[model samples]
Each structure stands twice: as C-alpha cells, then as structure tokens.
Target: MLWVKAFHVIFVISWFAGLCYLPRIFVNLAMEQDGAAYQRLLLMSGKLLRFMSPLSILAVAFGIWTWWFYSFASGPGWHWIHAKLLLVVFLVGYHHVCMRLHKNFVAGRNTKSHTWYRWFNEIPVVLLAGIVILVIVKPF
Candidate 1:
C-alpha cells in the first residue's frame, strides 16, 4: 500500500507536469506568427501529450488502488476521498479538453487567443491544490 501510494504520487506529479506545460506550449502556438515555430510548437505539444498519457493512466490506476484499500479497509467518513475523486474527474476532463484544443491547433482552426491559453494553463494548478489539500487535510 505504501508502494502504491508512492507510485500514485509519482505519476500524479509527472502527469501534472505535462498538464501544466502543454498549455504553455499552446500559449506560444497562439502567439507564434512564424510558420516554422508554430509547427515546432505543435510537434512539441503532441509529443508531450503522448508521453503524459501513460503517466496519467498509471496515476489513476494507483490512485484507485489506494482509494479502494483505504476507503474499504478503514470504513466510513471518507467524504474527503469522494471530493478528491470528483476533482480528479474534472482534471481528467481538463486533459480531454487540452487534447481537443491540440487537435484544433493541428487543424489550424484554433480561435482562442494566447491570453485564453494562459488562463487555461492555471486550471491544473488550482485542481492540484485542491487535491493536495483534500488528501493532506481531509477537510470535510
């Protein structure tokens, strides 16, 4: 169980690295006027998304394993776990949105400004803060 929790934290940190960075790449993509630079940023973002996908999967798997063991073995008053899970679901949805936005960029159909992506890039930070607080403090 300790191993599981450790791996969960490891992978979550890895996944969050990409989640926090890909959008910064998008910010450059949005601002880039040079064709070569735009294409380069697109390649970087695509590769990053691919690399992080497995990390995200592993994180979720370990998280679920930990959650199952702790929630059931301990029994009751795990509302904080439930809330953290909800935030995780939203985080996953945010990842999906990033993928969609990447696709839009690939298609040369992105309509959002760099400012929008700058704001978007802050999302995972907020989610991560919430998750960490829930896990550490278990605030009801």
Candidate 2:
C-alpha cells in the first residue's frame, strides 16, 4: 500500500510537469503568427495534451483513493483535507480551462497578449506550492 503511494506520487509529479510546461508552450504559441513554426507549436501542444490527459486523471483518482485508504480514520482534522481538496479543485478547473484555451489556440482564434500568457504561467507555481504545503505541513 505504501508502494502504491509512491506510484501515485510519481504520476502526480508527472502530471504537474506537464502542467508546468504547458505554459512554456503557450509562450511559443503566442509568439508565432503563422506558418510551419506555428503549426509545429500547435502539434507539440496537442501531443503534450494527449500524453497528460490520462496521467492527470490517474493522479486525481490515485490521490483520492490514497486519502480514503489511509486517512479515512480522520486524525489530522478535516481542515487540512478540505484545503487540499480546494486546491485540487482549482487544479482541475485550470486544466479544463487550459484544454479549452489550447483548442482555441490551435484554431488561431485566441489573440491573447504575451503579457497575459506570461501572467498565466505563474498560476501553476502558486498552485503547486499550495498543494505541497497542504500535503507536507498539514497545518492545522
């Protein structure tokens, strides 16, 4: 069971790796106006999305299952769990929005500024920090 946790953590880290790198792709995607380079970035985004889709879902499922398996007795208080859940919800929402944005981006419909995209890139940093703190500190 503990070994299962290691696998879960590995997948979670992989999913976060994809999430972190997606914004860098957005930077490249935003810079391109057209042609083969733009097409290349678009294709990269699609490939990354395909790779991440299942891993991200498995991360969520494994996270929940691990919690239910080990922490079902309720010892560290529900506050920590609640906070973690909220952050997970935010992650899921962000991923969904990113998927929609990627679709629009590939279609060349999104004309967002590089400035906006740069700001958006910071979101995962903050989110990952929050999640890490909740899981690590478990601050009452």
Candidate 3:
C-alpha cells in the first residue's frame, strides 16, 4: 500500500509537470509569428502530449489501485476523497480539452490569444493546489 501510494504520487507529479507546461507551449505557439517557430512549438507540444498521456493513465491507475485495493477512501467522513475525485474528473476533462486545443492548433484553426492561454495555463496550478489541500488537510 505504501508502495502504491509512492508510485501514485510519483506519476501524479510527472503528469502535472506536463500539464503545467503544455499550455505554456500553447502560449508560445499563439504568440509566435514566425512559421518555423510555430512548427517547432507544435512539434514540442505533440511530443509532450504523447509522453504525458501515459503518465496520466498510470497516475489514475495507481490512484484507483490505492483507493480500491488498499481501501484508501473506504470509511465514513471521507468527503474530502469524494471532492478530490470530482476534481480529478475535472482534471481529466481538462486534459482532453488540451488535446482538442492541440488539434485545433495543428489544424491552424486556433483563434485564441496568448493572453487567453496564459490564463488557461494557470488552471492546473489551481487544481493541483486544491487537490493537495484536500488530500493533506482533508478539510471537508
């Protein structure tokens, strides 16, 4: 169980690292006027997404293993776990949205400004903070 928790944390951090940076790449892509730079950023984004997708899957898998096999959220008064799970769902949706955004970028149909992406880039940070607080503080 401890090992499961450790791996879960490790993969979660790895996944978050990509989540935090992908949108910053989008910001660069949006702001880039040079065709070469835009293509370079797109290549970077595609590679990052490919790498992060497995991390996200492993993170969620280990998380569910901890919860189901180890009964991490089994007892009463585990409302914080419920809240965290909801946030996790939202985080997954956000990841999907990023994929769609990347597709839009690849299709040369992106209309959002760099400023919008800058704001979008902060989303995972806030979600991470909320998740950590819920897990550590368990403030229901």
* lDDT per residue (tens digit) for residues 17-59 in model 2: 9888887898888888889998988889889989998998999
lDDT of 1 by residue, 54-108 (tens): 9999999999898788654343667787788889999999999999999999999
User: Global CA lDDT of candidate 2, please?
Assistant: 0.85
In model 3, the runs with Cα more than 4 Å from the true position are: none
- Minimal lDDT window, size 10, model 1: 70-79
Where does candidate 3 have its weakest 10-residue lDDT segment? 69-78
Models sorted by TM-score, best on top: 3, 1, 2
Q: What TM-score goes with each of the models?
A: 0.95, 0.93, 0.96
Q: In model 2, which runs have C-alpha deviations exceeding 4 angstroms?
A: 71-76
Give the winner by lDDT: 1 or 3: 3
Score each candidate by Cα lDDT: 0.93, 0.85, 0.95
Assess candidate 3 and give its lDDT: 0.95
State how far residue 84 of model 3 sits from its true place (Å). 0.1
**lDDT winner:** 3
